[model samples]
Target chain A: MHRLILLLALFGYLPAFTQYKPLDASTINRIKEGVAEAARTTNTISSDFTQEKEMTILKDRILTSGKFFFKKEQQLRWEYTHPFSYTIVIRDDEITIRDEGEVRSFNTQANRVFAEVNRIIIGSVRGTLLDDTGFKASYTQSNGNYIVRLTPLLVTLQESLQEIVIYFSKADFTVDKLELFEPAGDFTRITFSTKKLNQPLSNEIFSLY
Target chain B: MRSFLFTSIGLLLLLSGCQSIPPRHLTPVSHHLPSDTFLPTAHCTLPTFFSPPTFQRALFKASMDIREHHLTGLLFIKMIPQLRSSRCDNDTVSLPAYRIVCSNELGMTYFDLEVAPGVFRLNYCFEPLNKNALWRILETDFRLLLSPEAGTTPIKTFVQEESNYLVCKSKQGGISRWDLYSPMGDTLLEVRGKSSLADPSWISYAEYHREFPFRINISNPLIKLKLSLSLLSLN
Candidate 1:
């Protein structure tokens, strides 16, 4: 009877302890290999982006169309061409935003929030999102797409963002959609279409105006 | 020594009592109008008008530095008969539209278009004042207190007095009063009233500076919107 009671207690606590156990060595190696393969396969990423922002105060949702350009070694540019003209370029550790004729630049290291955003964007582009220790990731296969759901580990991030869901094409593992949900019931859904991978891109494309 | 100490303490207490005495209250002047008549119509009309010869339409552009937020934008306005008209075809224009018609006798404004598409109708009646008074009223009341309408009427007006003043009340509960000086005060424009139908009870105010046409100060009881408008000439 004593042995049975001890066994039952141990079984009850085993599930909780196993919840955060490290991924198996083989799984970790597979993820790294997949990331390396994706990085090498994708030299330049160009895609048409459609962003929908649902504002909390306004009943209407704003639809914006833009183009996204990305190159290896963390160079990205988001150029909005319709509805209004705005461009956000991230090169190295600096971000420059140009709207109309005005230009504003800020360093990622100086702005912690922007730095985190840069890291997440870079990680997502490189298929290394699973390496971010600040989030717990679970993958699901849906409609020939890999859906990665990231839940924030920190309370502050969790308060602002409930979850970030990223969808990548299963055929080539290219990110096609990213949905961010804010705690205030607001959401931003960005969809990528006509994605061209491994295109030749010049460094001048990321130059600030 | 005991006698001397008691006398000093009594004198100190008396002095403290004199210092703590309440200030004399005087009866305030009864400037409130009777229940039947809230606003006085004595100085109902403005004195005169300063008519410029030609009406020019130009695209105005400016950059605003609003604290830390900067904005730039362009506005196209046409100086019409007695009113400054703006094109309302674009949904980007944020303010209301009004048709301002000024004649020798009175100045009339038509508010809330679409019922009578672009038709000018009599709205507010401004009695004629002198050119100086008109300039003062324009600077103080019309230019500053009123918002530049894109499709709505300017409803509120102000008349400046020494310290105490009378204000006409709008049916929507907005108050209009004019100042004694220029049409555009230190601040080019000032708008004070509830802007939206949702919050009819709340009072909001906006101030625009002539020097910085791109910057605006908007404040309500709850929040403040310091908007900067930067204009990039697409031309």
Candidate 2:
């Protein structure tokens, strides 16, 4: 019955994982090179992403589409623009969240979860997630795209998430999609598109409020 | 002597902490309408509009204030239709919903509960949050919020008080429940409950027409907890 709910939550599409079939030494190095090559010259990334959350209790998917911005040295912004307004910005290890008209800021030093999430997201966009010690990593290929699945090893994180899946485009080695599966069956999928990299993004993009 | 004093103080502190639930003080409401004659009966018939509301599906950003903890999450509610074979059974059957399947941003489920029309099912809850007292208070809050089928009628009605069209009062034992309705009595503006056993709790509706309230605010002054939600989208 839980599996049935999960299938419906995934919109009737049951994603079949063929097998773990971890890539061999040479293949792993090649994929790692692809990721490194993409990040070598990239300083900024700006894209529009559509986020979808699935809940067994909800018949229809909860949809929230937004624009994403990232700059080197750990600067990022996620601005939701549909249905409601919300924004989150990260700069210099500090996270700022804006809900409606209120703005609140917190530093990574105070919030380990925020710091870890920032590291995972930013690291995945770059080529640093391969070195993250908090998760056990595995690789799989489907439809020519490489999927790096990271299972949380930390007990605290494991309680919140079972796995994090990042889909890297085989062509550019850039992360095209990110999916976080919870300890329970619910999951959230975020797809990024129309990416602009190596552009001169302003620091003001990460401003509060 | 020191040990005896320490033990006595500890016992006193523990007793005080156990009384976290405050006693409610309810005063009789005075009629606002001058020259009004009709007094509401003890068990008057309530319009279906003022009854507990049922929804097919609803999503709200929820926050709970309990002591020093401020827990927040997304609350998803799906109303399941009761299966009925014959026309006669349609009105008699009730389904379990408002079992709020709550989750955080990472999608970790916090808790799932059926607050009304069925047994309170604590299907899943995160540890440190599985307190029976807190759950009971939460269940009472949700019940007052979603009980669209609540059949209790007003014992008294207050008309045209502070821009409100009408307000009806009901009581069961020591608990007092009040329902404020729009001028047409088609929309329920607020639902308030108070009892000697617990503190007062109320839910206010705003920015809505028809059956669904676009915004809801549920708060308990005694607990210093308030949950404010706006309808982002409805399908």
Candidate 3:
């Protein structure tokens, strides 16, 4: 199920290194407030995403593209349509996956990995990860984006994950890209595009069936 | 007194029957072909599917079923290029290096391994698959699937006129392996090895595309493991 988390976290923006500097305390507070306010009003989100994964042993970067969907409370659907077809839907502590033509379901509370993925992805979409005590967060500004770097403080997560960097648009406080770095020099970046927020999403999309 | 003697005899028989029985070892080949048709072939060549000369890399949609667990993922295989100075004249030289990586649908790796003749290195493996027995099983499976050129081992050939197929038998490390091929020996149909316990492990190939098998299924009944690979693309 690590793949499920990766496909969800891989929505990313371009890595054009513009001038970046540390944000002042006041600005940081304002950005946080803005993001929290945005999260409160955003009841739904739908977007197309592109993901890239880099590994030392691979001859080239693995590229994948997918669609992402989220609703209020705890409902999400991450679907990969490129290279291969895979779909993962999470609702109310349950995960349903569809690979090729096979379908399987698992309870998040019964599996540690699934539980973690559920928490992380929901926290990410709700803009609540910044306040998570499991990580230490730092703030920076680059051109029109606020970069939040979160370092894992939990020993278990630190074994596999080094840090997570989230790029939020200054104009709307919406996340544009997310990058996850591993201690083993592997990383995944996901960029979201064509984002539609607070739009009416069909209830059938979250069905376990 | 007679009842006591019968109980003792029963206990003794039970203990004798329960004495630890050694596991049945697998043989190299097992087939029921007639021995009269055996021929001493001077030369043997592997089919194009097993030949590594023209293959560089490929990708597949892979699935493995072991015990009660099922795993689906992407499998990438790349042949490592050897340096010019390491070239050898012997037909059965050390096997060429091949790097294989299996990852989940989205990109989380299950394991990464580098395999060659007498050289097996596990670069990375997921926690659940880190068992020594599992790794050894994978090593043996890959070694058999990606065998070296056929000339490296002395082989005896037999022709089954009724079945219109040829069988080549080769023994290594005292285990006999048999390869079943078409009459012309251009396409490999199946590979099987002998076993002392149950049915022999076997690999079957089908759905050829451009002289390569698009579907490959490997089964080891003793371990209750079945691994299948379907070609996705040639990378």
Best by DockQ: 2
**lDDT per residue as tens, model 2, A87-170:** 789887887877767787877766555566788889987788977888998888877578899999999778667899999989
Candidate 3 lDDT by residue in tens digits, B164-211: 566667753323466777766667787765322232457788998788
Q: Model 3, which residues run further than 4 Å from truth?
A: A1-22, A109-111, B1-44, B47-53, B84-95, B148-151, B159-164, B171-176, B182-184, B193-201
Q: Report the lDDT tens digits of candidate 1 across residue range B1-235.
A: 9999999878765654443211122112234334464443433222111112222222223232323433333322233332334566543422323222221100011111110123323332222122332232222222222223211333233433443332322322122322222322232233333322211111122332333333333322212223222322111
Of all native A–B interface contacts, model 1 reproduces a fraction of: 0.00
Per-chain TM-score, chain A, candidate 3:
0.86
lDDT of 2 at B129: 75
Cα lDDT of all candidates, in order?
Answer: 0.49, 0.69, 0.72
Per-residue lDDT of candidate 3, residues A46-146 (tens digit): 99999877676665566778999999988999898987788889998888888777889878776444465567667767889879999899999888788
Off by over 4 Å in 2: A1-21, A57-59, A109-112, B1-54, B61-73, B82-92, B103-111, B126-132, B152-165, B169-176, B182-186, B194-199
Docking class of 3: acceptable
**Which ranking of candidates, highest DockQ first?**
2, 3, 1
**Candidate 3, clashing residue pairs?**
A10-A190, A11-A190, A11-A191, A12-A190, A12-A191, B28-B175, B28-B176, B28-B177, B29-B176
Which 10 consecutive positions of candidate 1 chain B have the poorest summed lDDT? B104-113
DockQ per candidate: 0.02, 0.37, 0.25
- lDDT computed for candidate 3: 0.72
Provide the lDDT at A65 for model 2: 82
